[model samples]
Target: MFNVPMEVLFKVWRQKPHQSPQLQTYKLEVQAGNTILECLNRIKWEQDGSLAFRKNCRNTICGSCSMRINGRSALACKQNVGQELEMASSSNNGDVPTITIAPLGNMPVIKDLVVDMSGFWDKLQKVDPYVSTQGRKIPEREFLQTPEERSQLDQTGNCIMCGACYSECNALTVNPEFVGPHALAKAQRMVADSRDTEVEARLETYNQGTQGVWGCTRCYYCNAVCPMEVAPMDQIGYLKQDILDRKDAQSSRAIRHRKVLIDLVKQGGWIDERKFGVFVVGNYFRDLQGLLSLAPLGLRMLSSGKFPLSFEPSEGTKEVRSLIEAVQNHD
Candidate 1:
């Protein structure tokens, strides 16, 4: 006896007896304030008791119900079905608004909407997420931090580990070894905390192999999909800045690349590939292997006369310098 204007048809994928996945569609009338999680619950409890999905703390705190809603990763508990349907309807794709629910990509699916979280937990463990303070007397009550000191860790603490960001990340698509955004963001949080005295050790932990923070492409997908508005991309940027400030030699390659970019923009209005290659290699003979790899392309550019041998600083140098100074001062 319930009347509603909008109805959602969810095309849910479930595992079969042979371990194959199959899609099953279900239609449900949606109330004004109903979420996707609510719709799934109604379908399971009333229509088919065997339906499978995971949910806890329907208020978006548990992060257990992350799935792909219409090809994008979203927390089902936090996403409003009616609103998303409306948005999809308004799009110019001219397709019917049907929610396609699937388990998060790049992880093993356990069932209908559940993914094996062992990978996520394992990555978290590798980062050493907890604070490792040096030998210090125990506090009388609890470890206290100043307001300014506490604010640094606030942004990363908001991450609910929803994995939506990881699901959409392009770096993870290409480089499976790279540590995803959540782990790097967590590492940055601890590094910035004044109470933590093991900053050097933490940086070393984050810089291990090509899978560390330095491998991040700074794409900001993590910032977009976060339901709690935690900017993981910003945290990564902070980590990069911290690395540069420390002048770590292992991070010198990234520093050189960034400097090349800045120098190119300052000297000219655009980037010079020839100069960039030189900057990236640093003493051509030292990186003779890399130089040989790019020899063909470098020769083509040189022959084309597109490569500039020398250039003068642009008039915008002062402005760019000021901007860089502002960022450093603020951080």
Candidate 2:
């Protein structure tokens, strides 16, 4: 059998007593089949006894070995060094596959790979993740659900609390108060559960504040890094649809914003900035302070004769509206 020789370098985080973070490089000759987790274990056991990292079920299911590998969040146990090296070698950039293992971002680093999950746990607690019967006694028999009903909750329950989505999420980076993707996914799981009696209340909780679904920028980074394949962006979109269906009128800022943009596109086959700004920020007559804020920029555009009061309809406006109607009706 042909064996691949490995002499990879690991740029790992080193924590010393009463000091800030530091990166320490370690070189090792690993076998072809060795995983990143195995290499780290070898370094800890044979090379440096003080090296700190977490590994429980060596399998990917545990999610304990999540860290940044080659600038992407992935489970160390599942990552093959030889394959990563091969890809790096073939790339035009000639960037060698140097493993830069660090604690998952957006959470407090307790040690090396281990992050303090109190913040994550707290956000999850805020959502009240468990299904609430609300003063009802459970019967001896299990709750019966149709296959379709069961599938909705089952789709989101695959999340392993790995923090991969949290690390890649842009909303978490901008709004620290926003309940990150994992908590939202968990909330979505409960909201979709057929046995859950508090779907409306749960929906309200996710829509109430800035930390709610409105805060999500829909970057889809969470969908990419999720080990369980649960698309939090899709969950957020469904949550928005559910809220809109129920006519939760109070949370209509995003909806109004969306409608204004949609209507603009429908009328002209493109967005009308003047209308979008008026709708988004409110009417100019009603909100003088808001209109004044944009006065200078608006004047600059007016001076250039580019700021038209309204736009003529595009050639394909009717076709665009038909496409929109078709999609909604199909859904």
Candidate 3:
């Protein structure tokens, strides 16, 4: 509460799915400490009852009021009007500010600030994000783990399925089948759980091209927009690394690419570009088709004076190798 209410303009985005959106502005007398959700409720109650959005817990836990406030994804309940006003001030406006609100991106809007999250949920389902229960008789006891084993799950298990990461995902904007950041984040949870017995099979499916973790662009937008600090992109990276540690990592080209790069860098203090393609795509010179595919590109690079014909160890190569060795030993 404040001594007086400040008048700020709310530029809200209005549209239903498959319909043209309109910018509807409301002039409201609000206090500095008001949450965006509170302002929205006031607008709906006092001015426009038809303005549709979603809300449940009103606290940050439920995440129902997730939306774009000023072109960034955030929970309305967690952000106060005073902070937004400060942002407006810092933007060099210095005057009474206009705040813009819109629905989350990369998902179809149902109406106003609400979006259809069916695609988000569908992608999650494709990951099979649970430990398999087969091969064990039901015991009258809970599966147990030490605190160390259980701690790995706590970070990912905090996800609320808010669809925040999925909405801002760069990969989903181009490739529709790309398993979203949210799904992969949760998938990492299952992968790290000590009780899960399907690591190999799960990694195999997750390696499928453009359908699983391989499809992520690693733009890290998923990490930035996630209100809960789920760091979906980091979890996806962890899954990739864990997959590579398994015996079957080399079976997938994506995994092979990552492994080969690290190995080459470790051996030579940097990549020996000549061996990179053959070792990775050509499967250690075993895949004739992969070698044939690279021949044309290799010729073009050679002709353009861009191909590496000889390998030279970088200066301080020994030091670099020692650093890498230290990290590996620690891991």
Instruction: Give candidates' CA RMSD values in order.
Output: 3.4, 3.0, 2.9
What does candidate 2's lDDT look like per residue over 1-331, in tens digits? 1166656678887664355889888888876578889999989998988888788998888888888776668888888777556555332223334666777788777777777778888988888889876435756557778989988787797888888888888998889999888888888888888888999988878886569887889999899888779888888888877776676322355666666677678778888788777666664245667667778888999999989886777889899989987877886
- Candidate 2 RMSD to the real structure: 3.0
| TM-score to true structure, per model | 0.87, 0.88, 0.87
Residue 183 accuracy (lDDT) in model 1: 84
Better of 1 and 3 by lDDT: 3
lDDT of each: 0.76, 0.78, 0.85
The TM-score obtained by model 2 is 0.88
1-331 per-residue lDDT for model 3 (tens digits): 5545888888899998789999998888898888999999999999999999999898889888999888788888888788887776343234657888999888888999999988878888988987765435666657787999999888898888877788788899999989889999988898898988888888888878878888999998889978788899999998887776774535778878887887888788899999999898899888999999999999999999999999998887888888988977886
Q: Evaluated with lDDT, which candidate comes out highest? A: 3
In model 1, which runs have C-alpha deviations exceeding 4 angstroms? 1-4, 16-20, 89-96, 134-141, 248-252, 282-285, 300-318, 329-331
- Candidate of highest TM-score: 2
The residue-level lDDT of candidate 3 at 200 comes to 82
Model 2: runs farther than 4 Å from truth?
A: 16-18, 86-97, 134-136, 139-141, 248-251, 283-289, 300-315
The residue-by-residue lDDT of candidate 1 on 129-243, one tens digit each, is 8886653566454777889889887878988898887887788888888788888888888898887888988776675555887778877777887888878788878777766
